[model samples]
Target: MAWNLDSQRPIYAQIIERVQYDIVSGHYNPGDKLPSVRELACEASVNPNTMQKALSELEQSGLVYSQRTTGRFITKDTSCIRKIREELAKQQVLEMIRRMKQLGFTKEETLTLMDKIYEEATYEHTIGV
Candidate 1:
């Protein structure tokens, strides 16, 4: 998948978010080995140094850990993964609500629209649309 990075935010920060999403979404399973920093940099079209910085930050957060000679691996702690997943979801929801409010949507109206859109999306998925 493309990293789809933008200039609006720091590249390393974007990389962190991408990696976190991959972990939480099961693109990388618990205890799964991650690609090398060079490999990840190539994949994200970023500099190795930038990828290193991002991965280092992830390590600090206990999301990924390095094993001396081996490369980095995703944390095997399911609870930690769940916490990160929930944090990510909350951030997304908060952003969505902020945007909706800016567009003049009341909280209730936004909820209603969200429900409608979700139903439509679920139906589309069910029908293989």
Candidate 2:
């Protein structure tokens, strides 16, 4: 999953985003120890230095922490994780609204479309889509 990177953006930034998503989404739970930098680099097919930079950035952001002679672990702060989750959701919503406006849809129309889509999606999920 970490290998799904693109050339349009910085690889380390992408790695940070992926790791953050993993943490917030519960793929890596609170206090879970992370794999070694070399291991993550191997998994992402990136240079170890790139993975280190990403992890360091995440550490500075308080999402990850390290102990002496021990590996990095996900932060145990559920509130911080929740805040990050909301921030990510808001980013997606903002981008969706931006695209809708670009397509000439007003706020009301966008909301209506969203409602319809949500209903259809809910129905599909109920039916085991």
Candidate 3:
């Protein structure tokens, strides 16, 4: 439940991103009830209204839903979750490629670096790095 906020962007936006990341990272599984606004606010050290605003936005985006007498829950739509995951992955890859190019690597060289990095990462993962 780490909350990282900075002065550049609004806190609520950061909350939304963090929550979305949690869902995609399996920290909050599909159909899981989110922590209450007060709880989340406390965890994130922000005003309850800010957390509420963030959660409301998430619901509007169809990544979360609310039920009467219950609470907000992660969307059970696996396809939507998969799509979000894909979008996030694409963002990461593009950012990495941009950085690589800035470091003077050509597209093919950048891709080859990606393969090397991926192999090392996979090996580390397999050995519980």
Between candidates 1 and 2, which one is better according to lDDT?
Answer: 1
- Tens-digit lDDT string for candidate 3 (53-128): 9999999989999997899999999998888889889989899888888999998888788789878988889544
> Worst lDDT window (10 residues) for model 2?
120-129
lDDT of 1 at 56: 99
Report the CA-based lDDT of candidate 2 relative to the real structure.
0.92
Best by lDDT: 1
User: How much lDDT does each candidate structure score?
Assistant: 0.93, 0.92, 0.89
The whole-model C-alpha lDDT of candidate 3 against the native structure comes to 0.89
Maximum-TM-score candidate: 2
Compared with the true structure, the alpha-carbon lDDT of candidate 1 equals 0.93
Better of 2 and 3 by TM-score: 2
Order of all candidates by TM-score, from best down to worst? 2, 1, 3
Q: Write the per-residue lDDT of candidate 2 for residues 1-129, one digit (tens) a residue.
A: 558999899999999989989998789999999999999999999999999999999999999999879999999999989988998899999999999999999999999998898889888885444
Candidate 3 residue pairs in backbone clash: none
What is the overall TM-score of model 3 with all chains considered together? 0.88
| Residues 75-116 of candidate 1: C-alpha lDDT, one tens digit per residue | 999999999999999999999999999999999999999889
Superior candidate under lDDT, 2 versus 3: 2
Query: Candidate 1, TM-score vs. the true structure?
Result: 0.89
TM-score per candidate, chains pooled: 0.89, 0.94, 0.88
Where does model 2 exceed 4 Å of error? 126-129
